[model samples]
Target: MMRRNDGCTILHAAVIGKCYSLAIGISESYPDLAGKRNEKGKTALHLLAAKPESFRSGSAYTLRGLGMKSLIPLLILRTIIYCCIPVLYKESQPVNSAEEPSNSASIHKLSRRSSFANYILGFPWLKEIDDARQSHAVAVMLAEKLIRREDWSHYVHTEFKVLEGSQFGISSEKKNRMPDPLIQATRLGIIEVVQEILSVYPEAAYTFDGKGRNILQIAVEEEKWFLYDYLMTSGTNMDRMLSAIDHEGNSIIHLAAHQESPPSTPPGVLEMMWEVLWFKRVQYDSYPYLWHLQNSDGKTAKQVFETNHASLREKAEETVRALANTVLIVSVLIATINFAAIFTVPGGFDQTTGEAIFLKNRRWEFSLLMFYLAGGLFSSLFTMGTLLVIIFLRFETEDFYVSLPCYYVINIISIFYSAVLAIVACCQALIVQKVVITDFRPLVVLFFIYGLMALVLMETSYVIFDYAYHLIRYCLCYRGQES
Candidate 1:
């Protein structure tokens, strides 16, 4: 029944402590505390909305894929242990009620606290935090419970009135603005809270923050890609929401084009490419007129995007140029080596016949040697030519969108093939020489060389393949749009 000086009740304290049992018990017994705001005008749910780590959507992605295999057995063990807690508690009870301590309530509280602590300690990898999956479940359940008892309309009105008062010079009793749980959740990318609020009162989606931005706009501004997509497809008033602009007269498209590589984007994606993808995604979904529509700053969405990405484009150009120069040097060296290899002849020319000695003694070996030598030389020349084309071309920002990536693909592939052929030709030359070996040393050397080649290829082509993936996707999307 008592509250802290900050106006926070025991319900708020329980939620903050992440004591889910106490929080749920409090909500069930004294539901009114669920809606009570502290001095800051934040209820228990409002505080929870700001904590992204409590939800699965906000959990670290490192514990996925391969990590899941290791976690499965631990999760199963935790479940088994959790199921046995109640049985252990009942079995340990005193046989006679009279034998129980006068301070039995204290023991019960201590037991509950100890059980929760044990649950947390079950996962060593979890550290001091609860398992994300379990925390997420409790979060959803608490959100659902609060939403069921909340009168959302009063909160919505208060938020709007706070904004309206500041705008029209009307006085209000509450000076500091309270954060709206749904809007705060959207900003933090906590989709569970937003979803729960909207499911109960879909009209809450239409509410705006102090800056006159609805949840959709906030999602775009904060780069909450998943939440933005969800809001767009949640079958709300799409047209109205899409057309909604902030007080600054910037639409969702402008907001989308505003930021680069927000935390939501994958780390490996190229910055310029990620920026372009975001702008294009927003452009495609929004009305065409919005593309050229000027915001309060007298800039269109495209202009804002280009302005924001100017440095990224320069960096991309420099990266491509540097890669081309380095690869060009390697290609030239490969071409020289392979060309000379063609003339030397693996087993030297027969002095009398004036032909390769291998041609007469080992005709197939000579032919294979010539084939690889010629292939390596030609492919190296092709690589050098492709790289020259890329280096000489003007690296305009638009060129990065497609032209540079196309040339890079050709350059990398050709150089890779040339290197492989050159190595294989050298191995074939050893065969033509019929070099003597005692302990399978030659085979071991060959395997070692091939292993080095594989490692080098993987190291070199990792970034190239990443770029090529996004490039291919971009091309397909462009083609589809045109069609």
Candidate 2:
């Protein structure tokens, strides 16, 4: 019952079903079963490498709807807060010198290394084992769990033997070979799993995948910032890792230049920022000469970036245009409304004095109305001026970092000022009209409610614009693919 015709054992079935508890139970009772092979000469470990069905297939639409529900409110809140505050960058602290190890400490380190080596060389299944194609996957998973439970030094020196041929007497050319687990994990962006494998087997960092790409290259290509940052500080040989060139003669910088389209929901600005961040990080990490090094196509890293990001740059320009137009139109409308409100004061003019009726009797209401009108007019004018400058200015890729943020800030401020004006106008009207409310507290609460409604309106407009942009972009992409 434990072994099947296709060489699948009960352990294989358990692993396939992701029933770790059952696999452990079977392994404990039949320890020898760990060495058992199915008819195809594959072990239970191989089954673990098969891809799992994505939960997205069933729940993607629901999740997307939920995300959209929360996105606008969060963005509105974040935008308001961000405009109100400035971010500060902190200087990095210098590293302190470490004291030299004593003779006893040296001896202990040596003993630990020896013990780890012995543990690896002594493991029967790990040594002289053939047909353990997927064994590395199991080893990596176990190693991660062990690292979590135990100390890093315990497995720092462990190693495994690389077997050479098909174990089941099948043609060598037809054998299903497994790539190094570290490379596989790195490609998959499994940071914890890769970290465990590399910590115990530092030499694995030097291993290349089938594409002749190293860990750093994979991290750069995949945009796995967490993994890339980890490797940088992981105390490995940095020079070798940074200097690696893949089969296509593409360096780390070259790989970083190739941008994939971001998920449809992320704003274009954020996607551009991420691409810029990746380029800067890779540039900082690699040798300065890497910038000039050309790939097989005779294009420098900078050239590759320019070529790849051409479409993105165009899209960004389009977004900038749309944003400018939207802000300008909204500003004009607000300015027009405020202009009209100024003439039609909340309180009618005094028949004898030829001034506002509330000017002398209700000075506070008059003052609030004046302040609201003035603020709204000033904000609208400022927004229009900014939009004019943006529309006339030439925005290259380098300019986006500074200019785009400024535009967004101005837009938020304009919306906020307009919202405040609306709230103030509402409150002043209620106060001057002698509404049923005696307590001003309800008016204040109503002001807040009006402000919130304004924010919701502004945010809803942004969401609509973003979705429209995405829909158009998707249609274009689909058409391009079809063509």
Candidate 3:
């Protein structure tokens, strides 16, 4: 019941200490405490919001990735040993009938009885408490209780500007106004907290932070693509947010343009391509008129994009040139290797007819080897042609956006195909030459090669295909609008 000098209650202490079980217990016992603000006008939810580490969205360790995942089995084994030993020891002790029913000891007896009962129910009487799970549970529980009680409105400001000194509680005039939980969560990429707030109170999506930016705007500016995609797909009044502008007169599109390459995106040309794709996605999603709408600085979203992405585009050009040069060398190497393989067939030529000896003896292997070699040579030549096209093209900014990437995709695919064919043809040649028996070892090696090729194909193909899909969709939409 006692409070700290700063007015923080036991609930706040429990949350701050990461004692989620005690926090949950306290909140359940005193629901009103969850709604109470400390001296700083920050509720327990505000504290929870500030500590993103409490939620899964804030932490990097997933359920499968958690270190505890490996330790759970061992902990359970230890618990079984501890539980069984105590039961065995208690069974050996003499039952004292005279001391069984004392009035003051009944509670202790009942506690033991419940423990024994739980032991019989196939549950571990001794279990390790997972602080991460407990903390997340407490966070969700508090959010639900606070929202259901309508206590969240005070903490989620509508138009309050987060002052500079307000965070440190140094501004006596506005010391009571803490950061809004929704805005803080959005800025921190805590989608769980943001989702919980919007699920219960859809109106919270309308709340803005100090910059007059809502959760959607913040997501775009912060480059939280996962959160942004969720908001777009959740049907949480996202269409309305497209028109919302901040104090700087920057709409969601403008904010999207201002974001640098996301950390998850690869550096170099892919980063530049991702930035261009992101801008186009946002521009197409918004009303067409908003595309040209200028911010306070009199800069439209396109201008904002140009200003931010100029260096990225130039770097992307250099990267493409470098990549093309490298792939060109690879293509030539593959061409030469495959070309030499054709002259020296797997088996020596029959001197009488100048025919491949394996052509008649190991017909299938020879045919397959020849087919694979021909394919490899064709693919290598095609890749070389594409690389030349890419190398000679005008490296303008606009070309980097679409033309460069498309040509690069062709070059990469051709190179991959050529490499695979060459490797397969080599394996086939081995089979024809009988260098090694067509037994376990060769089959394993062949399988390993195919598996590795498939994995590389999956990894690189997805990004190329994704970029293409978005570009095509944007073009189609633009053409539809034009018509």
Candidate 4:
């Protein structure tokens, strides 16, 4: 019943209503909503067919007080729904609304339509259902027509695949491999269909398709703006989707960042940018941070698009690289400022001045310092005490601009705080051990241990390689560096 302009046509809705309400032997399709009890087993078709008074063929009806004549073909096909109809039947009539199937073929086509819908909905069907596959073919043909007309959502809702091996089949994947429903729905701008499928098979949305293309990647490729819109506005944010790679190993942001320009054919690609970026999809791939992301060939989407479409590739590359440079500078500056306060570093911080002017920044210095120090201290302590047992806590990825692996940051910060508490801890341990006399032997061993600390520092730096690279790049960035 999905219409061209709107979603479902009144024609389809009426029929579906009948099929749903009436179990068998009647036109499953009708618009008599009063008799249509979606919640009740009293189907609209049953209500219509099981009229208080019986109607017969060739009857003048009102003339002798006889009921209405029979014209609705589906209503009449109910005598022997399974045996009477072949599931593969269809009409030769040029696709017209009036030209419904004469018998089992027509019923089969209708049955196919319903079955396909149920399959996509993850519902089981009865083995006795007839002419179901043929109806699926007709539905697919209709969806294809609608898609050509750019009524993507309508085509999408159909699932049009019960006709998989039928005469009008278009299942692109091999018999064993089918296109991802999420991708199919996305490519066709079928938001409702995608959502329904997701409800039935929520895992499918996250599955990468045959091309290694995730739903978001496919949506961007097809430029299904509305699908993109629905994805973001419906609470699926940019950061989450863009971060994921399709089976083909492409991220949606990578697709957007790499596309030379919006494909000339579809306007959806460029138009949906507003929705994606606004939702924090981490869309700007114009940075070196993302440059390292690789597809199956070890080339990123940027490399692929640039290779395929050279004219505008430089523009994309420049934008991404420049942005990455800026971020590098910002991160380095922040880390530098932080490092300055923590250690008596030679390059950036003046140790004597830092101590002398600790509170010289005056004004709210005392209160602000108290707040940050005390608060940061307690919060850090509490967090460590509560979270240390769970190692994965350090690895949790936040979607905020920082997108830092909190597990790493929290644990690293906690380690530093513990190092600072060494003096107190040592005092307590000393009280427990009662070893006050000079421990030259332990000190000598400790010196050897300190030598290993250098390697530990190097390993720790490597552990944060990606993050550290960004910081260092930011600090070192200069305008228009050659090569």
Candidate 5:
């Protein structure tokens, strides 16, 4: 209504707080001035005219007492603060009129064939030919690369099969046969397309082809190291290609270890392979260490060849040990030092006793002693324990009782060390720690370090391997869906 009166004063209208709500209700009776605006479509002058009229007519508003009428502008200001801005906010946001991607049927359909096919076909490829002709291997690799280009497509189709074969120079019995194309692709390291295909064909990803090579083994043979590592790691089979033979009973590691030169399985290739199976700590059919793993000929990976190959095996062993055990080594050392240490290290001899009881010795020994102090040593319990046990064990013979005190003292010291180590490793990760079967010591720190490293290796292997496997399966799924 004030708007209808051509008032410009927003402050006066706001200061008279309750009037705004009343104004809102009375507003519908008149034309919406906001809509029926001036020729310039502006209301800038409306506010100025309204304020002074309110101020001038309010002379009787001087109550000289306590009534809400005296506090109109303050109340209006409060009301504007508490009410006005909030109301405006509610009207400002854009409404979500667009629907969500919600059809289960369409989702399932997309995961089926058409999308997979489209992904496979849609991906662009590099057309460079490999130089070394010794490898029909290269052509096979290219063919696989071309085939993998559409991996996100959910199903296998004739065109994909044709592309797969044409890329590799290998023909197949049927148009939609998946093996040869993927085999080539796996060999080629065509990751993008492969991932798309496996998203749809998860099960098929694990299947083996005519040469008795699963796509994984084929990948290894084709020296597609990433695929080999992925297959070894995928958690599908920790032992997947460990024992897989390439027409001769040679395992994948065997082939890798047997590469005729210095860096063994190709410098960069080993790294890719390692990433795939880095965390995988599969118990070898024989021993845990690759240096100790033997082939069908009963030769360890280290023993695969006599000279340079042996060096390669040694290097692999070194790498494995270093990666898997570094954490455990450091932890164990810290834990060990944190574990043992009762009497003070002899900085000098005991002059009063006149006997050379040089107790604590080296840095490692001192480190071993540190564990108990860190644990807020309940050593007093050990002292009390020694006294009690000493009494019980040596009541009849006091001479034997002397030894009993000594025994009790030794045991108390030992137990404190044991408990501290248990606390550190267990407290750290909160894993249900395996019972440490071996005896604990400073040197044992190395064992703990090695174990942790192996655990990391296996775990890392598990994650990446599983991811690659999914990618492999996703590629298939995408392929099928595309088809």
Candidate 6:
């Protein structure tokens, strides 16, 4: 058939619209249609590569129009079963006669052909490739399809061949090939797609793009944490992956050191904390030589991190200084209040005996007041001392992880103790006033409330202490591991 004015044939339009059935039918009848190009010199593959959305939506509409929507579930189930079937059966088959293909061989070939047919017709590649353009919903689907297809090796090779012929290659190996779909998926941060691609084609993870950046390098450079974490834990050879240097001589650590600014809401302290964690994790995961290795710029990983995170370090320092100052002020206020309360006892002193008027008469109440007052006074003093230490002490990065939480816990306990002391002292003052309480019910209620508040304070303090202890232990363990 003659091409349209825009040089797009019927098959080109169908592929562009993601009408797989129509495109397949047209291609089957006129195989030449697959090679036909549009006015922009883009073949059917180029049209499919335009954007995932165009093909995905078009395929769905086409499927519904053809009343094949119900078959999607069946196709998926068949794909799964087919993928799981052992390939060891292929090895068990007897040698085929050269004169004529054996039934088993024919059946195997037919099954492979049928699966590929289903792959092309069932919208397998399109769904994953398309969703990977924007999301990861169908990544597994794409991976399964690729793994299930007996000709997947040939298929991928042919696709690259077509890409090369189309002049998509820029510089290196231009006459040979271009980046595969898997490389493109990794660059796009479609983590599942990359995972699936690597699962089916493990060697693809090492394949570099035009810039000589592998999947791991791209993940670090793009700051895709999901992909990065997955790559780290997915049982890949960490030593090799980390050791890979890009064209610029930047290793994985160097790329990580170039991480961009964190989100604004988490405060600079957390940002710095995460930065430290990443630095430590990479150091732990990679070889010691990586730390000393210089990039193309002749800067080590530490140097790169320091240069990139200088502003972050400054911001973190400012945040910590502000926090410590605030805590110091609160501690001073609580200490002053507690110290003043010592002299201004709840009851007035006797004129001659020079003792609190209620101390002898209400010895129990006076003892309780003194106990809480002393507790608050000591806790506040301790908090103040800790705050001073925090302000003046030069903490290495690792030390802050252990010290900050402990300091915060002390500060919180001091505030709680002071508040409880103030409440108890006020109640004691009322008792000293000798207000008429013939009912006795009010006294019982006050005592119950005070007891409940004490219980709550004790429970909260215990929880904070437990949490801080575990955190410090973890920090110590982590530091030991690093050493």
Best by TM-score: 3
Query: Model 4, residue 448: displacement in angstroms?
Result: 91
Q: How far off is residue 192 in model 5, in Å?
A: 2.0
Highest lDDT scorer = 3
**Stretches of model 5 off by over 4 angstroms after superposition:** 1-179, 207-211, 219-229, 232-246, 260-298, 305-483
Per-model CA lDDT versus the true structure: 0.70, 0.59, 0.70, 0.38, 0.35, 0.57
lDDT string for model 4 (1-483, tens) is 224333333433444443322222132222232232333322222222222121111112122111122322322233334234344433333343544422211222323546664464343333324334333333333322222222113112323234356321222222213223345446555454455455444445544555655576676766554455566545543443555554445555456544422222112211122222322232332233444577656776546644644433333334333433443344344334333333431123236674423334332433343333343344445444434333222321121113332333454555444333332333323332334443565455445454555345434433233333433453354232111
Q: What stretches of model 6 exceed 4 Å from their correct place?
A: 1-198, 219-229, 261-267, 349-369, 394-483
Compute the lDDT of residue 290 as modeled in candidate 2.
Answer: 75
Give the per-residue lDDT digits (tens) of candidate 5, residues 148-221: 23332222333312235332222232222232334444544554334534553554464445544556655544
Model 2 lDDT per residue over 1-483, tens place: 546778788877877776544564465445455556577654554344332211111111222222244555653443343233221211222234224211111100111325564476356643322112123233334333323322223212234233346221111111113334456556655565666667666766766666667788898897765567788879998776777666677888999998953233355654665576567557766777777888878888989998998878778777777778887898898888887888888668988878998888878867877788878888888888888887777767765544565566666667667756766666666766777364868666876777786666655455334433433443353321110
Error of 2 at 215 (Å): 1.9
**lDDT value, residue 187 of candidate 4:** 58
Q: What global local distance difference test value does model 4 have? A: 0.38
Off by over 4 Å in 3: 1-8, 38-40, 51-53, 58-139, 146-150, 155-177, 396-402, 439-441, 456-483
**By TM-score: ranked, best first:** 3, 1, 2, 6, 4, 5
Which ten contiguous residues of candidate 5 have the minimum total lDDT? Answer: 101-110
lDDT accuracy of residue 79 in candidate 6 = 45
Estimate, for each residue in 310-369, the C-alpha lDDT of model 3 and write its tens digit. Answer: 787777778888988998999999999999999999778999999999999899889999
The estimated TM-scores of all candidates read 0.68, 0.64, 0.74, 0.27, 0.24, 0.53
RMSD of each: 9.0, 15.9, 10.6, 24.2, 29.8, 14.6
Residue-by-residue lDDT tens digits, candidate 6, 23-52: 544554565565666776555544444443
| Model 6 worst lDDT run, 10 consecutive residues | 101-110
Ranked candidates (lDDT, high to low): 3, 1, 2, 6, 4, 5
lDDT of 1 by residue, 137-156 (tens): 66767777777777676545
Model 5 has how many clashing residue pairs? 84
